[model samples]
Target: MRKPQQTPAQATTPYIDALLGYRTRGMVAFHTPGHKLGKGAPPIMREVFGAALLAVDVAMAGGVEDTRESTGLVRRAEDLAAAAWGGERCFFLVNGSTSGIHSLLLGLAGPGDGVILPRNAHKSVQAALIFSGAVPHYVEPTIDPLWGIPLNVPAERVAAAVAAHPESKAVFVVSPSSNGVCAALDAIAGVAHQGGLPLVVDQAWGPHLRFCSRLPLDAMSAGADAMVTSVHKLISGLTQSSAIVARGERLGLQRLESVVKMTQSTSPQALIYASIDAARAQMATQGEQLWSRAVDNAEWLRARLAPLEGVRVLSDEVLGQDGVADLDRTRVTVSAAGLGVTGYELETALRDDYGIAVEAADPLNVLLNVTYGDSHDDVALFAAAMTDLAARRRGARPLHGAALPANWPRFTRQVMTPRDAFFARSEAVPVEHTAGRVSAEMVAPYPPGIPIVAPGEEISDEIAAYLSEAAARAMHVHGPEDLTLKTLRVVS
Candidate 1:
């Protein structure tokens, strides 16, 4: 007997359609609106930007969903998200995770305060340092020798950082790095709370984690004071959708909201707002069923790729003692180590040659982010492509004659505040000659996207070499240096 195929009724289309038609009962706006729906915006508001933007800017005149104080649709959406993730409060974000991150940091820190951050963090956090005028102390995460990826910072590092900076305001971490390496969040939170500091985590790729047990624990459950998640990264929301999920009152929601308002657009897109509302509703309604499909698809892909030569799938082998909580199976991280080509090369070939776009391309690994939208057949196609790629690059010479270094130049020495150096008087000079000057921009490797030389750090000769070698291998680096590393931007 043949197994029954899944039905289309189980499709996410119905829920998505419902969200598309979501209605806010507010007035159509007429005073400021030329069409005159009779709402509360300036007369020029519609003319300055466009009618479409202001058309959706209706207030909760009668029965419309209110967003400011949250009564109808907004409250419902947030309640749905809160219940889905076990968070007490979940607020939608108009801008990307950048806005959410800045808000969280400002809520917890201020001038003269110090924050503990992982050395390998998004440049946005460093930017937050300038906005809030908070000093930052660094913590380096563990390196996985076999895969050549940076794992999560251990709990001990957070503890050490907090202890060293006794006045630290918050413990910040990125769980399940962009490469899919997770940290022990529970322990990290314990350390933060013990030190009387709230824990702030950036879990941008983990919106689906709450629905599935196979994934690692999300920031909210780990007792983090607040977390910022980008739904566009992995969830089914539009490209710029994100949210700030709080686990407690320590983060000061009022202050966070003010910051969010300041950074976000006054005339928010109803389309984006509706999408978030629908995403929240979907998760609230059938998260388990959808998330299970995504997980199963990823696992099926992992199993198929295991038989290929030079293709290694990380299991417990990649995770160290108390190093990671659980692997996000959805993010399929395949190390191209010993496969004769850098992940950057594979990424280009995959997209250009095979028409497959990977989530990220790095020197050692390619990250393929799977989501609820993809099916088992999609993963099958990816696995087949990898099989061919493995065969093609086997005899290719490495970009660097020597194998990847067993160790990287340690991230030592912080000379100035990242914020000051970024906005200060700076010059663009040759990379080779930029050794002593403080960097004025970020030079980050792709897969991790963490800055080795951020705006305020002094670049080392060893750090420069790792990047040049990586570029030779076709790795795409972002920020000041143009991947070639011929020139770097620096503070004059």
Candidate 2:
């Protein structure tokens, strides 16, 4: 007879068991935690977290330590996660996927090394570049002129970038953008491996992809060397909890572990670890059913909104574009341009008037995320609110002025690496006068967090005009001390 297969509960939650076992043992107070597992803490403090939570708030040493020879339960939990996500190794991240991205960069590439990435990457990718002192070879993502949104980067771009920068250490890509548009990761990964490089994917918004058949291919399944995903984004984990999964020998596990540990807190929270493990268990056991309901709920809402004149709910047809291979239907992105309102105005109205919180917004579209936790009732309420707003917009003029420039400003020159410029002598200058100067800091528009200006980039007239226009339109621009765009930081 064949050996019995282990159940989901048996495979996952090893760390949870270890934590709970130690919590239930009722051992003497821990050594480090000043609270000593709620005993030394004030009654109110204990009351705040409640007995059950405080009970498991033990240190990593006494309670959870198994042995040096045998890999601990935390390692087991990570192993289970690796198996669940289809990776060779999985590491639990308590500092969020930001840390994982940093780890991937720091581990694979270092000072003077090149890492090819897309221009529409998250700010964390830039931070990782700075941390690793790696030079970035930026590829432009496909831009949708009609919607004013960046779609996926094509695989040919990745291949061409790799060919151009044959000495580059790794290729990095982000899939299922915040608004749910996805790249062709399998093709991209094949391109990277063909050029003798590892692919590092920042799948921070795609934690549920592996579990849902309807979702796009996850980084692991696509044969990425390494991938970082934020568990809290779509999976039911604590906010800071994430996982970085890796495969193959192209990238060393030791280096990845070092960078991860260096960035992570020495005193990692047991609660966060437990939550991640529990989330893995939940995903392993019941994710398909949960995602089915979520997709149904999203479709229900989209169907209701599609008939409304003012709102145009984006469908999977957008995936048929040249670069976009797939679209995550869970993101109910509805364009408000036809409604004669800015996405910002629509977001404000939804929150203030209807008490509905959306995920994000750009000038044209407001994004609503449907997750396992969402219900049909929740969708019904949001649909009704949107319907009311559509009815109220009886040919009102768009509150916004002009659509953003079709093409964003491209860096004409790189004065220095991001690390060097960030650390070099810097001074603040009037934004208008800094057009020709190399920037010492990043300047990004908030709604779509891509950086219009990054360290070491030569700022251009087009960039200045775009930023000024964004500010004039009351868009929240981040990374600049002067919110009004009057001044900018530049390398002297």
Candidate 3:
């Protein structure tokens, strides 16, 4: 039987309504005491203004919500989120994906337990290891030399890991990576679940996936046990606003919420929650429409840019290679190899001249994110600007920078659990001398936001060389200090 067309409100999730209610009720809050919703926020802003929205900064009001114990508004919001995302339970994360990952690692898995993780994850994953005290098994990703960016880890690698380490309690992987490269989640999840482990997807870049099937499949639907998303990344939410979707009977909502409460802020931003609700409402009503528009806009943009000289545009072909299942087309990652400039040079010119900033600037490629709000005109303008750039360059282009190091490094074995290495007495060493020693920090190039080296992994000379090249390009790589990577901190 054909299903009835859903009304916007019917599509409106319950979490969306709760968010509306918070805004609708503007009554002065004196109950939580600290918030002073009508009064100034404490210490940080010794404000005396009653009208300041900053004062809306509130505490866990007894009657409204209790994020720590999560029995009030938080409970309802999470319930609705689960229904919206088709997960068994959903947890709100005011602290962002970092906290969600930390909580999942510490709560779902145990000390001495092993967790397999993608080498391309963020620093927060390293933080999770420190807190969880779990041993980590590393999985390397395929680097596309043409793009100079790391792709998602293959399913075969994951399956092999699961087979090798049956004791692994969980696996961490990301889809719709910052550059928009995606992986075969269903296949990875199949491996984890078959081995009696939970698969955790750091789907921070993929919040809009489920809203439109044309984009990519949502992590939950792909059988991941838990998926973390940052609403601020793709939607109109305040920073640090995030959510964790958990499916399957294997996970415990009570335990997960406890971990969140343990790590998250006590005085949660009602603003963050409201923003999440607002995004949810927008998605509920115009999900298919909004995402549909975004996808169409991206398609139009890529097609227009494809013919431009000196511009090599990357697409599903770059992503759909051996290990991946699907590609996210929203990210237009263009390499100026054919042109006479590095991505950095083009990015600087674009900002200075056109006043249009790309998503991220790197040595090789600059990513431009296309959303539902963009129009064909914007795409045409971008293409024209590139054409002008190519014409100016003529036949001249910057010499290709040092070729990326041929061989990358890998960790030998688990010398110590992350929690142990993090806390164990340690000392500083030069980057070159640090090889074979456990790493104390996450060092990675920016733009793509993928860490080439993370905490607890054995440091290597090759890794050091790759990082040095990135720094030479003035790339924003987040990690320990460069050169010697000196003053290294270890378990003390």
**Whole-model lDDT for model 1 versus the true structure?**
0.71
lDDT of each: 0.71, 0.82, 0.72
Q: Give the TM-score of candidate 3.
A: 0.87
lDDT of 3 by residue, 367-485 (tens): 88887767878877888788777778878754465433323445445566767766667776655455566766666555555566666666566765565554554456566654334
List TM-scores for all candidates, in order.
0.84, 0.93, 0.87
Clashing pairs in 1: 25-64, 26-64, 28-37, 29-37, 29-38, 29-39, 30-36, 30-37, 30-38
Q: Which candidate number has the best TM-score?
A: 2
Model 1 CA deviation exceeding 4 Å by range: 1-72, 392-408, 467-475, 481-485
> How well is each residue in 105-124 modelled by candidate 2, as lDDT tens digits?
98988899999988888877
Cα distance off (Å), candidate 1, residue 317 = 1.1
Best by lDDT: 2
**Deviation (Å) of 452 in candidate 3:** 2.7
lDDT agreement of model 2 with the native: 0.82
Clashing pairs in 3: 340-397, 423-491, 424-491, 424-492, 425-491, 425-492
If candidate 1 were superposed on the true structure by all CA atoms, what would the RMSD be? 6.5
